[model samples]
Target chain A: MNDMVKLEKVVKVYGHGATEVQALRGVDLALEAGEFTVVMGPSGSGKTTLLNIIGSLDRPTRGRVLIDGEDTTRLSASSLSRLRLTRIGFVFQAYNLIPVLTAYENAEYVLMLQGRRPDERREKIMGLLRTVGLEGMENRFPRELSGGQQQRVAIARAIASEPELVLADEPTANLDSGTAASLLDLMAQLNEEKGATFLFSTHDPQVMRRARRTIVLHDGEIAADRHGPAGDE
Target chain B: MIVRLAWRSLWRYRRRTSITVSAIAVGTALAVFFVTMADGMYKKLIDEAVRMGAGYVTVEHPDYSRDLSIGLVVTGISSVIDEARRIPGVTGIKVLIQGQAVISTAGGSAGVGIFGIDPETERTVSPLADRIVDGRYLEGADERGVIVGASLAERLKLRPGKKLVLTTNDANGELVNEMLRVTGIFRMGMEEADGFLVQVPLDTARRIFGIGPDAATRVGLVLASPRDQSRVLEDLRRRLAGTEAAVLPWQAVMPDLAGFMAVDKGFNYVFQMIIMVIIGFTILNTILMSVLERTREFATLMAIGTSPLRLRLQVAVESLFLGATGTVLGLLLGGALSWYFQVHGIDFSGIYSDDTTIVGYAIDPLIKNHVTAGAFLLVGAFVLALTLVIGLYPSWRAARISLPDVLRSR
Candidate 1:
């Protein structure tokens, strides 16, 4: 499999001098294409920071980050933004959809950034919304939808542009067990059927059990990495 | 889509948007109203000044304005008056012989300006004939008869038919004294004119001043419309080019009033600038607060690959929506109010003890506002530009938001 993301000796420090806190300490990792992986860790264990560096949402303080074999750590901010726009998609813990836009518009936003033709964007967005089981609720805003529905719209948005990678930071943290299971099923179905790579961060045992590969982190370092048949997948 | 997003975002906080819009609307309306009212008042003042013997055009000896000497009288008064009458906009022309003199009675003595006018012709150029409050106006048959202002009459304790002595130098530098009977007492509602002016017949004045029968100090021309002052003056100047007389428009004769009008316009603009500054700050505060509240939302957009420039443009678009709505509403409201006041003037008589005059020009107590298309264009452009400038700060702040920090905070 082609490697999609590589982090080399990444280190992240917050604040300065004696008050500084080290969030990531010389972390090295890589994700292959079409992999359904979860980075598991307790609080303050650098799972979110590692995800941020991989997604190009941030730059590591003292290491190189590569996305699809391009060195993203040396790129300018604008170049990095373009890299994020064309190559990666993100889903936040809070299900960050633009409140003013409807679900359909929120899903179409990345395609709009890509300057896709209207008819093609419409076809792809409609298909994705249906794939995520949000076909009839396309016109509702985020506030009008439940947590599960909002996360589903966010997933549709993440895959609308057919990005190379999707980084979800605690995608199901706020949902009930039934909704979380359904969301995970949809994500796994997309990965198996379309070969879309997803790297998620979570501390939940149920979420870890649903991933095909699991990497455990403790005290800002990776403690274990393993791959197996995900339960019920 | 960006515009749609911005528009929807603005209405999300309905009460805050309404407050800002209302502030802009009220500020703009007041600016429009005050500017229109001031313009109308200035127009009225100019018209009144033209009617009070400073007719639209005046023909005088070249040196008479500076010296005021009886010896500097124009010799060919009849020809000058005839030429002035032929001008297209000229409605009337009158010969005037003005000199400084002293009037005395049993009660007191006071210095005054004596105006020699032809009663029949002067009636067409001045409202003095209509303002005779106590006695009959001067007629061609009444020789040695003078019209005094009510204030002057009161000071001299003289009534109609009472005689007073007028003393001034004739053409030969000798003091010439004449006995003049008061034929009328006029109250012009202007302290300068009422306190120190007395009028007599032209023939009587010429005889007392020892000049030729056709000689006069000045000739004043009235126009069919005050707006034609410059055109008529130009025509008169071309006609009287070779003579020793100089033609002057009323603005030249009343420089102080002209300068005062210019200063008044400056003050009006200062007032408008002050109002715009206050409204601009209000807009700035409102937009800044809105941007601050949406910090996390902005960070989300950035994370989702929205460029900082596009985010800033969205904020600017929101401000444009607010500004456009407020300005349009303000113009409509101000235009309607001005129209009502134009048709039915605002009466200020209750605010003053009596009719007030500014710089010897009497004005009616009722004032009207004139709403021109220019005023609407000016106020609209000003408000829109101000709102745009005020939008810049908030937009820049939005563009500079630290995405990671904001997302982490949320």
Candidate 2:
């Protein structure tokens, strides 16, 4: 399989002098295209930092990050933004949908950023919303929806632009157990049917059990990388 | 879509948005009221000053205003008056013989200005004929009577029919004196006129000042519309070319009133600036608070691939909506207030004396506001521009927030 993202000796340092923190310490990893992977770690183990560096949301202190074969470390801030817009999608732990926009607008945001035609944007966004089980709730704002529903809208937004990689950082952290299981099922279905690559960070055993590959992180370093059955199906 | 987003964002904090809009509206309304009142007050002052003695246009010898000497009289006065009366906007022309003199009665003596006017023609040029409070105005054939201002009469302890002696140097440089009976006492609410000016018949003044029948110090032309002064002056200047007289509009004749107008305009601008600054700060505070409160949301937008520039533009659009909404409301409220004042007027007699004068010209205590399209345009532009300028700081702050830091906080 072709590589979708590559990271070599990536180190991220926070603060300065005596208050410094080594969030990522010389971590090296690669994610293959079409892989349903999970990064599992305890709190402050640099799972989110690593995802940020790979997604071009943060600069590494010392390392090289490549996405779709282009070195993102050498890109300007504007170019990094362009890279994120065209090649990557992000789903945050809090399901950060814009509060003012309705479910349909939130889901269609990335497509709008891509400047797709209005009819195409509406069709693709509606299809994704339906796939994520939000078919009849298109006009409801984020405030009017449940935690599970908002997360589904966020997921639809992430895949609407057809990015090469989708990074979900504890997307189900705020949902109840049953909603979390349902959301995971929908994401897994999208991965299998559309050949979409998804890398999620979680410490939940339920999530790790469902992923085809699992990488464990300890103290800002990767401890083990293993493969298992794609268990949800 | 961006516009829709921006508009929707404003209503998210409904109370805050309404408060900001109200602040701008109140500020703009106050500005409109003050600007209109000041404009109307100044116009009233000018009208009163012109109607007091200085007609819309004045004709005099080149040095008459500065010297006021009887020797500086305009020759061939009847011809100049005839020419002036022919000008289209010129409604009436009257000859005036003005000179400084000393007036004495049994009780007092004071230096005063003497105006020699043709009562019949002066009636058409000035309101002095209608302002006689006691006794009768001068008549064309009555050459022995004079009208003294009320203050002058009180100071001299004289009444109508009392004899007063006036002394002045005539055109031949000889001191001439005349005993004249006071026919009327007039009060025009002006200190200069009520205290020190006396008007006599034109023939009586000619005899006392030793000037010829067709000679006078100046000619005052009255116009139907004061706005037509310039055109009539231009016509008079052309017609009276080669004569010994010079023609001047009232603004040239009364520099103090003209200068007051300029100063009043400057005061209006300064007042407007102060109001705008206050409203600008309110807008700045509101928008900055909004940015601070939505830091995480902004970061999420940036992570989702919105450029910093576009985010700033969205904030700017929000500010524009607030400014436009407030300006329209303020204009409506202010227009209603101005229209009410124009009809009923604001009575200042309770706050100030009824005889209050500004820069030597009497003004009515009751004032009505005058609104102009330019005032509305200026106030609207100022508020809109101020809101937009104030929006930039919050927009910049939003653009500069680090997405990673914000998300990590969440």
Candidate 3:
């Protein structure tokens, strides 16, 4: 498979002099296209910082970050937004759906930003909702739904645009074990079926177990690189 | 969808918007009433002037209205009448013959100007028919009848069918006496007019003055419109060229009345400005506050790619929405009031029943204010435009809100 994302000696620094702290330091990594990869770390481990750099949500303070063979660290804000819209999809731990919009509308929001036609949105969004088991609950608001149901809606929203890369920041941090497993299973299924790359930042054992590839980081640097049950990596 | 969004936002602030709009409506309504009433009252003054001494236009024995030179008098009424009748827009003409006279009666008599007028034509031109509270107008030119001014008739204690001895100085320097039966009492409601005016037949005036049937002191020409008074005077100057008749406007005949209109117009404009200044600030204050409150929403919209200028335009739209609705409501109410007043004029009967003179025009003290649609629309538009323009500052502040502050706070 093609390499979907590559990072080389990336560093993110905050403040200066006595107040300085480094968030990411000289970390290099790559993941194959259409792979389900999970980065596991304890608190303050820079897993989210790495995920943010790879997802095109944030840029590195030093070194180069490449996605689909183009250097994203150098892109301007507008260009970065365009890249995020066309290529990268983000699923936050909090769901982060607009309070006023319903489940179906929340899923429809990303596609709208991409300027997709309503007809195109209707077909794709309906299919994704069905796939994520939110078929009949499309009109319900996030506040009105169960935590598990809302998470499914968030996952459905993240993949609704058929983006090439999906970055989930602490996807199962707020879900029950059973719901977390089911959500991870759904993401794994989508990653295989659609050739869509999935990368997640999580401390959950179940998520780490389900991931086909795992990267372990400690104190802002890579601690280990490990593979799934059969030792593919 | 943009319009739908704007509409929804407005509905969300219905109470506040309505209050602001109502304020504008009331302001516009008041402005409409004031402007139209001032305009109407001023027009009425001109109409009364037309009804009084000065005809819409005057043709003289050339030097009459000018230096009042008696030598320039027109010699023949027949030719002057024929020439004046052919003048375009000259509605009517009347010959006025006046001379000083004294009378004796039980109530006491005073000197007055005795005018000679054709009874038939006089009925058409003067309001003499309306003023006959106790008697009838002179029957005809040869009826040997006379209409005395109310105050003059009162002074002489003369009643209809009573005979009064009239005396006038003739052209030959002889005093002439004739007996006239009181026919009607003419009332203009003016102190000077009521005290001084008396009407007699043309033949009687000629007989008393010892002049032939032809000569008269002045010729009066009534025109189609009071606005045409000056234009008619100009035409008379050209038409009666080389004649001794002094072509003059009523402004020349009665300079005080013309000065009254000028002063009234100036005061009206000053009052209009003050009203606008006081009310315009109310609209501006409401609109400015509305913009300041919607800062975050504006920032989100701009972050989503709406230009700053378009955001400002949205504020303007909101102002127009408020202004237009209020204006429409005020117009409906104000128009209803104006119509009611027009139908049943307000009466100053109680206050001025004893008689009062206002700026030299004898009128009721209670003046009803009338509103016109044009005035309503103009004031509404003026206020709306003011509110929208003032909204720009707050809109700009909203558009400039930074995204980091909003999302970070989020």
- Choose the strongest candidate by DockQ: 2
DockQ score of the complex predicted as candidate 3: 0.09
Q: Write the per-residue lDDT of candidate 1 for residues B36-154, one digit (tens) a residue.
A: 78877886677667655647788888887788788998888889888887888888787888888998898798999888888987776678888999888999878889999989999
- State in Å the error of residue A16, model 3: 19
Superior candidate under DockQ, 1 versus 2: 2
The deviation in Å at residue B164 for candidate 3 is 5.2
Enumerate residue pairs that collide in model 2.
Answer: none
Please tell me which model should have the higher TM-score, number 2 or number 3: 2
Interface RMSD of each: 1.3, 0.9, 5.3
* Count: clashes, candidate 3: 6
Better by DockQ, candidate 3 or 1? 1
**Residue B251 displacement (Å), model 2:** 5.3
lDDT by residue (tens digit), candidate 2, A1-233: 88888899999999999999999998989888889999988899999998899988899999999887889999987787788888889998888899999999998888898899999999998888887788899999999999888988898888888787899999877777886787788778778887778999986667878889988788889988878632432
Candidate 1 has an lDDT of 0.85
Ordering by DockQ: 2, 1, 3
How do the residues A153-218 of candidate 3 rate in per-residue lDDT, one tens digit apiece? 878878888788998878887788877777777777778888899988887777777778888888
- Show where candidate 2 strays beyond 4 Å: A1-3, A32-35, A174-197, A204-213, A225-233, B53-97, B104-108, B116-130, B136-146, B158-166, B170-183, B200-252, B258-274
Considering just chain B, what TM-score does every model have?
A: 0.80, 0.83, 0.78
Error of 1 at B70 (Å): 6.1
What docking class should model 1 receive? medium
